[model samples]
Target: MASRLTQARNRVVDRMVNAPRDTDERALRRAVAGKTVLVTGASFGLGEATARTLARHGAIVLAVARTAERLDELVAAIEAEGGKAYAYPADLSDFDSIGPLADKMIAEHGGIDIVINNAGKSMRRSLDLQYDRFHDFTRMVNVNYLGPVRLLLAVLPHMRERGSGQIVNVSTIGVRIPPGPRWGVYQSTKGAFDIWLRSIAPEIKVDGIDVSTIYMTLIYTRMSAPTPSMRKLPGMSAKEASGLVTRAIIGREREITPWWVTPAQATDAVARGAVTWGMGILHRNSSDTASARGEAVR
Candidate 1:
């Protein structure tokens, strides 16, 4: 009886997985018409959705990710739908490889009109764990902070020469809230990117190159397997986030997000203690879930 129930649940999950592909929720025809866009981490989650949307709208997309198979699949899907795309596989964690990666893309498709620096690392770890796992913090910064900076450096020269470009650095809302008990490594690394982008935005603004930092809320993605409370809170869909991203790139918006962001930022400023306490409650629940899952895997 238990096995039969498990099989039934698996079948339901399979149906949900297959449903999105069969009926085409792709607004690809309208979103990216006549744009050349570069999306980092295009193998999965938000990056993949943005890449697909841009392609469907008639933009030529350059998709980069560490996973070759996923990139290949995305490229094939775009081509099958009568859109243009180029896939490049290079791990964002390796900053040294960024120069050649940019060169290859330019050689293949010319320079991009917009760059989405959306590739990042996110791991939730307690402060107590950091002493033994400082490498997690180091790696996170290398990929999340340094990688995007290097890519910007490489691509900006072409964009400047052409006299127009946009870069959307996909940071997170975690910097505002500092919601913790975990994410000591993740938050610090992403915070570094946010600060650096703000500092450098002024210098680049004069060149017709707009640098926009997008602080995102929880989105529906495989990586965003949140606790019950977070799941209950209103989360952004990848599709909705893609719309905001498109608006920022095409219109050169200074910043883009849902209206909730203003209040979230204010709460962080005036009542940090209360917010941290609230996060503690959530993290406690998350830790138990992670532990149980870890034990089951073992």
Candidate 2:
């Protein structure tokens, strides 16, 4: 019975997050063929799948990640499949290094046609436990917000000069949903970028550069592995999530979110007070349970 329920939930989730229709690979190929695209966090998960998919569709994929070895393997695999790819390993969190990396990419590729800001960090530690761990907030903001912004600032000029480009930000649904306990760090950082991108979208559009933000839900990836409680929850696969990114690339939509997200956001806003109170109670219960466990261990 539990297995059946899980399967049903998975089906619902798949429908919610998956693209409204199957992407025509032929169309994707035509859109990206011979274009240079940059994908961050390309070592694994959604980024890896996106890089592979874009490369297969004839894009010159510049795969960037911290893992040089894994990126080399990805590039080699793409090459073996007759796809064009170049692995560029760099730590996104290292703010000082971004400018040089951008220069190198521009020099090599002449300019990027598309940029997928998919690199980010996720945290789920309770606020109570993070009382002394301020680094949690800083780290997340650096990687999730600052890193992407810096990279964009570095590349935006080049895109502007060409008078054509696309920027796809892989955001999270948490930005639109009610603020949840234990996710303050993650949500805030993601929210920062979401707002930043929205504010700049119109301005960039004037320069003929399209901007897209995909408010992705839970996806099965290494970043989501730490939250064991979420393991059984309905989530999209990395490949499915990658397809949505590709859809955004081809369609050039301003925003892509789950079909149910609008209603959920409306409900959350309407019941804000009650939701906050209930979340407070849940937080207290979680804290009490943890204290009890500590006592039992002692």
lDDT of 2 by residue, 1-298 (tens): 4698888976776786554533789989998999999999999999999999999999999999899999999999999999999989998889999999999999999999999999888777676667777777788898899999999999999999999999999999899878888878989999999999899998999899999889888889988875666687777778878888998998998888878877778877899888789888877675423332232110
Q: Which residue ranges in model 2 land beyond 4 Å of their true spot? A: 1-13, 16-22, 284-298
Give the lowest summed-lDDT range of ten residues in model 2.
289-298
The TM-scores of all predictions, comma-separated, are 0.81, 0.91
Best by the lDDT measure = 2
Colliding pairs, model 1: 28-56, 28-57, 29-56, 32-57, 33-57
Report every candidate's CA lDDT: 0.75, 0.86
The pairs that clash in candidate 2 are none
Model 1 collision count: 5
Residue-by-residue lDDT tens digits, candidate 1, 1-298? 5698887975565333211121123443443567689999899888998898888778899999899999999999999999999889998767889999998887777777889989887776556555666567677888889888889888989988888878887878777654566766778889888898889888877888888766777776755663444566555567756765666565566665545556777887899888888888877666534532232110
